[model samples]
Target: MRSVALDLGVHEISFCEVAGGAVVLRRTVRSLDSLEDLLGPSSSPARVAIEACREAWAVHDTLRNWGHDVLVVDTTRARQLGIGQHGRKNDRLDAEALAHAVERGGIPLAHVLSPHRRAIRHQLAVRRALVETRAQYVTTVRGILRACGHKLARCTTEGFLTVLSAAALPAETRQLVGPLVTALEMLTPQIALADAALEQLCTHEPVIVRLTTAPGVGLVIAAAFVSVVDEAKRFHHAHQLASYLGLVPSEDTSGGRNKQRLGAITKQGNAYLRVLLTQAAHTILRHKSGDDPLRQWANAIDERRGRHVAVVALARRLSGVLWAMWRDGTVYDAQSAAVASAKGLRLQAQSIEQQAQSMKEASVKARRRQRSIDKGLGATRATARSRPVSTSRRASMH
Candidate 1:
């Protein structure tokens, strides 16, 4: 049996091959594309195995395309079964160990991500990184401005630089801020171009289209969700997706009893996806209309417990909703959600009604103010007319 493994590193990818449990080939692949030359044409089908890494999916896809039966193993289990415990850790041992582990079935196998999916996800990952980097720079610039007692307006619709540049900043502060403004100016065009690329990607992606069906999930959130999960079928239920996203409550159970504590999210898996989901949840809470069952549940919890807890709870629910929609291809329906989750739905409607009432009152007050202003203006005009402008003396005399 000819087997191969790649010792994945940030800067370098080392390759090792084993035949009949003996080291026969060793080479470092500079990039994923270089793997083609290493695997020679064998008379029979070859069994290849490699530890799951950031680059594992791409590499796995490439190997599979070359007509090899590739096994992607969980790195943790592979570590437990082989050379990880040994004093010396190197490419040679890791490759052999992966081969042995695969032959023995000691490690759980990883799914080979399709090239199409990998390409789509790669685009999403790049977009995500750029967005986060842009946010970091914006925060840094804002901090500098705030430190000097100059406030920047919060407006993401316009580019960060546009907002900052339009500010009436001190000349000295502007001098210090010029480079940051210029950097943001540069990033803005790149971010727009990236967003257009992502949108084009979304046009053909069914999963993204399904994810975006939920009320508040935009293209960015949908892309992030799809990139992270890859396959919703992998998870059985919404709770599974929630747990995967670290949206579920952490449990403390002992002595045959389980205790629930209110703490920050465990934040265990796919932090980026969780943030996107939570942000989407917050948007729904703020802007969504109608009798949403999930919204009702959140408001009730907020009233009984607190706003923070409610928001988290809602976020968890949102995860399940996303999963259900993705898994079943069902569109969102208020009546259906309310029927299924009556208590949560009722509470959401109540909250919306309350907001509606406040708006209604504000509208009434504005109308009354307008009427009063109109009445006062009319009286002033009548008085001016009654106070008679002096007639021209020549006309009166004629």
Candidate 2:
């Protein structure tokens, strides 16, 4: 089959078609609607490729419906296809290069989302934007108040406007932030409605509900996971799921001894879902009212490597756990996990005790050494005083 590449621009769409490693045709169109003019829909289905972006998947579905196999190339790897080189880049070059790359094959493809799941993802994105905008407005108003020796008491975002109204404030102060207060009041109800929609979605999607059975996996977290993943079977294992979510340490190894260079997570995936997972991790860590094997495991890491690293590690593990639960069609089993981790917990306890004992012993040794030095100094002073009178005999004679 032949290959085709599309570069969707703000005002123009550039496309290239290639067959047998030779260019068949290339053109620039004014809009996506103009695409049908260059190629016949009933012709043999070509392998179409497009870089992953906001419009990429929609175009993918459109092309697929028209009888072509579409590949949404992973944006992170688009450079590998020579989309941009030197200092020059344009729609025509990008489309041509992508077309040739598609013809040659082996380009990495982005994860494809079903239309239903895609709609869910878009809804979640909109909700996130709304929440963030509200937060920005709240922060600005709070900053203004703080500058004037006033502080707002803690309250739910929904109750923030009510709280502000009840707090004693000068007329000028109230007048100054009136617009932001209005915005917050407007946002709160919309956020509530968005939340209700998610709850309705959760009711219909059994997989999302199943995911929520894991601790710290709330409606939002579960929904985000389900929408982003689309299907559980796509990942063969929990580790792959975590990696796909970019919760794993990134590695770069090369040359001489091939030493692995491990670094922070490659945030090459959906950042929204990743941040949600991290926030969920923080919630689990802070919930001292409940204890479980997962919490115990995270505490052990916290003791060894501080709280920050442990939180990230827990987030990664939590992602994996969620994936496993979804894959196996089982809820989190606290008893089984606690039993499995009992041995490690015991070892950690012993290790912590040993470290404390070692520190105590070292402190005692340091005190003893200081005492010995003090005694030596006293003796030296006493001997020097006893010898001082004999040493001054010549001075007395003079």
Judged by lDDT, which candidate is best?
2
Candidate 2's residue-wise lDDT over 61-92, tens digit each?
A: 78887888888999887888888977679999
Worst 10 residues of 1 by lDDT: 341-350
Scored against the true structure, residue 363 in model 2 reaches a CA lDDT of 45
What TM-score, over all chains together, does every model reach? 0.73, 0.81
Compared with the true structure, model 2 gives a TM-score of 0.81
Q: What is the lDDT of candidate 1?
A: 0.67
Query: Each candidate: what lDDT?
Result: 0.67, 0.75
Task: Look at candidate 1 and give me any clashing residue pairs.
Answer: 293-345, 296-347, 296-348
Please give the TM-score that candidate 1 achieves against the real structure.
Answer: 0.73
In model 2, the clashing pairs are none
For model 1, what is the alpha-carbon lDDT of residue 90? 76
Backbone-clash count (model 2): 0
